[model samples]
Target: MLVASNRGPVTYSLADDGTLTSRRGGGGLVSGLSAIGAEADALWVCSALGPGDREAVRRGVGEEGVLMLAIDETVHSDAYNGIANSVLWFVHHMLYQTPLEPVFDAEFRRQWASYESYNRSFAEALADRAAEGAAVLVQDYHLALVPGMLRELRPDLRIGHFSHTPWAPVDYFRMLPDDIAARLLRGLLGADRACFLTHRWAGAFADCCRAVLGEDALATTRIGVHGLGADAGFLRERAHRPDVEERMAALRAQIGPGRRAIVRVDRTELSKNIVRGLHAYRALLATRPQWRERVTHVAFAYPSRQDLAVYRDYTAEVQRVADAINEEYGTPGWTPVVLHVKDDFARSLAAYRLADVALVNPIRDGMNLVAKEVPVVSDAGCALVLSREAGAHEELGEDAITVNPYDVIATAEALHTALTLSPEDRLATSRRLAERATALPPTRWFLDQLEALTAVG
Candidate 1:
């Protein structure tokens, strides 16, 4: 069996002595693999992402069962940052302003070529390692073209592709150049099964296939949905650690007295809606002056993808908004918005514990785990203010205060409503959200997908 993704379970980093040390990577994919590690004879194939990773590839350091493909830095950047993150991610999330961006000129075609080459590298690696009739699972938007490339290399292999982002509707999906759009669809259709995080995303992909490849294309490949749920037991134990406890104390002091806490923990991803969320916090202050000094918005906007200019600009915008809010409503005794850009797991858990209301209002997400994780880790049963566009909303919406991600004013009102909810109701809702969120644990989710793939063979 083989698993291929742009990222892998482990990454290498250089130390002061210039020795490369490997560390386990984070994310649900890693957790899922961990669950089935004992039973499966699996090899992971990924690209060299950083300097240390490149060095590891050069030295032939195959940490765990991984095969590292060291692509040229320029090619990797064009493929990963250009085509994958900037283009495919934007189209899928509907984040592009449309008129101002995504002009797929000659440069885009060049990057598209790099994207194809990058996916092909993984395909070649998998074909080299996979046994006869082995099952191969390719992951995410970064490697959407891998299945088709791999199918060309080894048609005997049973291949499945899982998309971890929302799929664009047919109209929006056609935003790509005609050739690029057709290539992506054909690439994915080469798989025996195509999987999405939610039925909404799966249906969108199916619609696009029918629109481009005609109605009969569905008969060639099956579509599956597996909304990856949160790991409740792991979160519960980790959230209660002494490190998290220490962070909680520090956060409490920072939050101060006589003020309730409104918490948001997110990477500064474009689709996270951090800027609008901050604006909604300001709106909350403006419309309700009584709560101005009585509430603190603890925004843990951790830096993500700083390599790109757009992500850097978005991150700066988030800080600017937070500063603007503090300037507008702050006093000597009260800071309305307490924003932190550092990535701190313990601090995030602490914020989850102290939150009076947990705000997870992404413009679009495959699944916002924070919406589910917060409920499982809340010390006092925090009310959840979630975006309906989030994939997790399908499972957590009934218990959460759902709001339109694009509507800042509506979100502001929902925040207030969430904050004022009765304690009994908050507890009940939290209980329900936690229960449903953990219904499909990481192990089961991975196994279910694998089991479904076996049916394709």
Candidate 2:
């Protein structure tokens, strides 16, 4: 079996002492592969994403079962930041400013060329490594073109493509250049199976294919939905670890005593809707004055894709809003908002365990794992303030206080309702949410895709 993605299961770093140190990677793919065990005949084909990765490639130092492609630095950046992040991400997230943005100029054409090249490199590597009739799984939008490219190279292989983001509705997706849109649809169709995180996204992709390439475009490709769920066993065990326990103690100091916590942990990505989430939190405090000092919003808006100016601006805006809330409501003994920009997994687990409510209101998302993860590890039952747009809402919405991502007032009201729920009700809801959240663990999700892909004719 072969796995292709933009990043591998591990990263290499050059230490100051001139020795290279390796760090294991995190994410569903890594966990799924670990569950399968190292002895399985598998290779992870990924790009050399950093200077360290490039250096490691140059030095002929690499981990077994991993193949890192050393594409040209400039080409990598153009394909990564310019095309994948700037174009595809915006289209899928429906994030374009519409009238003034996404100008497909000369530079865009150049980036598109590089994007094709980047994907070609992956396809060639997979072609080289795979045994005849081996299964290949291509991951996410960054490598959308690979399935088609690989099909041409090795027709005997069973190819499956999994989209990890929300597929844009037909109308929104039409915003892309006509030919480019067709290419993307055709690319994924090259696979015997095309998979999405939810039924909504799968339907959207099918809609796009039918609309763009006519009715017969999907005749050969089977669409599947696999809503990735939380790993309950891992979360339950890890949340009680010594480091998490220590971080929980530290978080308690910051949160103060006898205060219920409203917690959110997210990277400051534009699609995450961090700014609007903060606005809703502020509105909650402003409207419900009695709850001012009784509750604290523990928001961890970690930096993400900082190399992009828009993301940097968004992260700054998140911090600015958090500060404004504190400045308006903070007292000598109590802070209304305890915000952390740094990313810390142990600290996140601590927040998850201590949360009274978990706020996961993304503008649009394939699946918000944090929404699924919080209930599994919550020490005290946590009410979920979920966005209707998140893919997880399909499963968790019955128990969650679902809100529209764009409606600040409604979201604030939902938060209030979540906080005011009786302990018995909260615990009951939490139990259901956790059960639904882990119905299909990561290992099961991965294996299901693999099983279904191999069965495809």
Candidate 3:
């Protein structure tokens, strides 16, 4: 088996003292690979993101023996920021402001060429590495065109493409140039099987194919959905560690006395809706002044993609809003929003354990793992204020206080309701949600997709 993605299972970072340290990758891709990535012949192929990574690529060294693609910095930037992040990510997430963005001019065409080249590089690498009848699983929007490119290069391989983001509706997706939209659908159709995070996203992809490439395009590709669930066993064991225990004590002290915590763990990505979440918390404090001193919003907004101006601005806005709320409501004894920008996994797990409420309200998401994880680790049970837009809501909505992510007032109201939930009811609901959330562990998810790919092959 071979895995291809823009980011690898591990990345290298250089410290000020000139020592090189490596960190494993996060997210579903890495989680899914934990079961199979260590096999003797398996190779996880990925790109070089920085100078350190480029050096590693030059040395042909990586974690778990990954194959690194060392494309030129200029080409990588154009493909990553210009096309993949700017164009494709915006389109699929329904993120474009519509009037001010998405101008597909001559510059866009230049970027599109780079995007094609980047994908072709991945195809060439996979073609070189894959054995006879080997299964190639290409991940996410960054490599949508890879299946077609790899198929043209090596016809004997079994290819599958898995999308981790929501597919835009037919009308919203057409915002792209006619040629580009059709090319993407055709590219994905090159796979023998195309997978999505939910049946909703899967059906949306099928709808796009029929609308853009005609019905014949969908006949050969077997479309499927495998909603990846949390690894409960892993979470249970890890959350109980000494580090987590130390963190829980630290977080409780930070939260202060006689106050319940409202927790949210998110990157400052646009789709994550961090700004709006802060607004909701502010609104909740404003209207329901009773919760002002009693409830604290312990938001973990870790920095993400700060290189992009929009993301940087969004992160700044998040900080501004959180600060404003704290200043507005803070006293000698209490601060309203306890926002943390630094990334710390143990602290996040600690917050999970101490949370009375888990706020996961992305405007739109494939699946919000935090929604699934908090319940598994909560010490005294938790009330989940989930967004209907999040894919996990489909499975856990029955037990959660569902809200519209775009509506701050409604989300504020939902927060109040969640905060006021009966302890007995909250624990019962949290347990049930935890059970369903981890029904399919990462190993099962990987094996299922592999089994499907093998059966077809």
Candidate 4:
């Protein structure tokens, strides 16, 4: 078996002493694949993301069963930042300020060429590494072209591609150039099975194929949905570790005595809607002054895609709104909003365990794992204020206080309702949410796709 993604399960860093150090990654994919055990033969093909990675590749030093391609830096930047993050990400998330931005000019065409080269690198590597009739799983929009490119190189390989983002609606997706839109659909259809996170996204993909290439364009490829779920066992055990416990105590101190916490942990990505979430919290404090000193919004907005100007500007706006809220409602004894910008895993787990209400109101998301994770690890059951637009809402909406992501007023009321829930009611809802959230563990999710892909032959 072989897995291909833009990032692998491990990374390397250089030490001042000229020695290299390696660090393993943690996520659903890593957890799922690790459950397969070391005995199973597998390889993870990924790109070199930085100078350290490129050096490690050049020196032939890396983890066994992993291949890191050191493509030219300029090519990587154009493909990664120019096309993938700037263009494709915006289209899928429906995030364009359409009238003013997204100019598809000569520069875009050049970057598109680099995107093709980036994917071809991966395709060539997979073709060389795979055994006869090997099953290959390609992950996410970054590698959307790999399936088709690889098919042309090796017809014997069984390929599966999984999209971890919401597929844009038919009308929204048409923003791409005519040729580019058709090329993306055809690239995805190259797989024997194309998977999405939810039925809505799957339907959107099928609609796109029909819209771009006629009604029968989807006849050759099968569509599947496997909503990834939280790993309860891991979260349960990890939440009680010493580091987590220490962070939990520290967070409790910052939150003050008898104050309930509304927690949100997310990267400051455009679609996360962190700015609007802060607005909702501010609305809650303003409308219900009695709860002003009794609650604190603990937000962890870790910086993401900082290389892009728009992302940097968004991150700044998040801080600006958060600061404005704190400045407006804050007192020496009670700070209404407690914000953290750094990325810390143990600290996130701490926030998850201590949350009284978990706010997962992304404008659009593939599946907000935080929604599922908080319920599993909450010290005292947590209420969920979720966005209907998030894919996780498909499974958790019944138990959550669902809100329109764009409606700050409704979200504010929902947050208030979540904060005031009786202990027993909150506990019951949390139990149900956790049950639905873990219905398909990460191991099961990955294995299901693998099984489905291999079964086609």
RMSD of 4: 1.0
Q: Give the residue spans of candidate 2 off by over 4 A.
A: none
How far out, in Å, is residue 441 in model 3? Answer: 1.6
Tens digits of per-residue lDDT, candidate 3, 1-457, equal 8889898887887667756677776665566566664663778899989877886667656666588888989989999999988888888889998789889999999999999999999999999999999998999999989999889999999999999898888998888899999989988988999999888888889888888888787988999888888888878888999999998887787789889999999999999988899999989988999987898899999998898999999999999999998889998888788899999998899999999999999989998889999999899999999999998988889999999999999999999999988999999989998998998767788778878988894
To one decimal, what is the Cα RMSD in angstroms of model 2 from the true structure? 0.9
Off by over 4 Å in 4: none
- Give lDDT: candidate 4, residue 441: 86
What are the per-residue Cα lDDT tens digits for candidate 2 across 275-308? Answer: 9999998999889898898999999999999999
- TM-scores of the models, in the order given: 0.98, 0.99, 0.96, 0.99
Candidate 1 local lDDT, residue 282: 95
Residue 217 Cα positional deviation in candidate 4, in Å, after optimal superposition: 0.7
- Residue 278's C-alpha lDDT in candidate 3? 90
Model 4, span 277-357: residue lDDT tens? 999999999898888999999999999999888899999999999999989999998888889999998999999988999
Give the higher-TM-score candidate: 1 or 2. Answer: 2
292: Cα error in model 4, Å: 1.0
- Candidates' C-alpha lDDT: 0.89, 0.93, 0.89, 0.93
For candidate 2, the 10 contiguous residues with the lowest summed lDDT are: 31-40
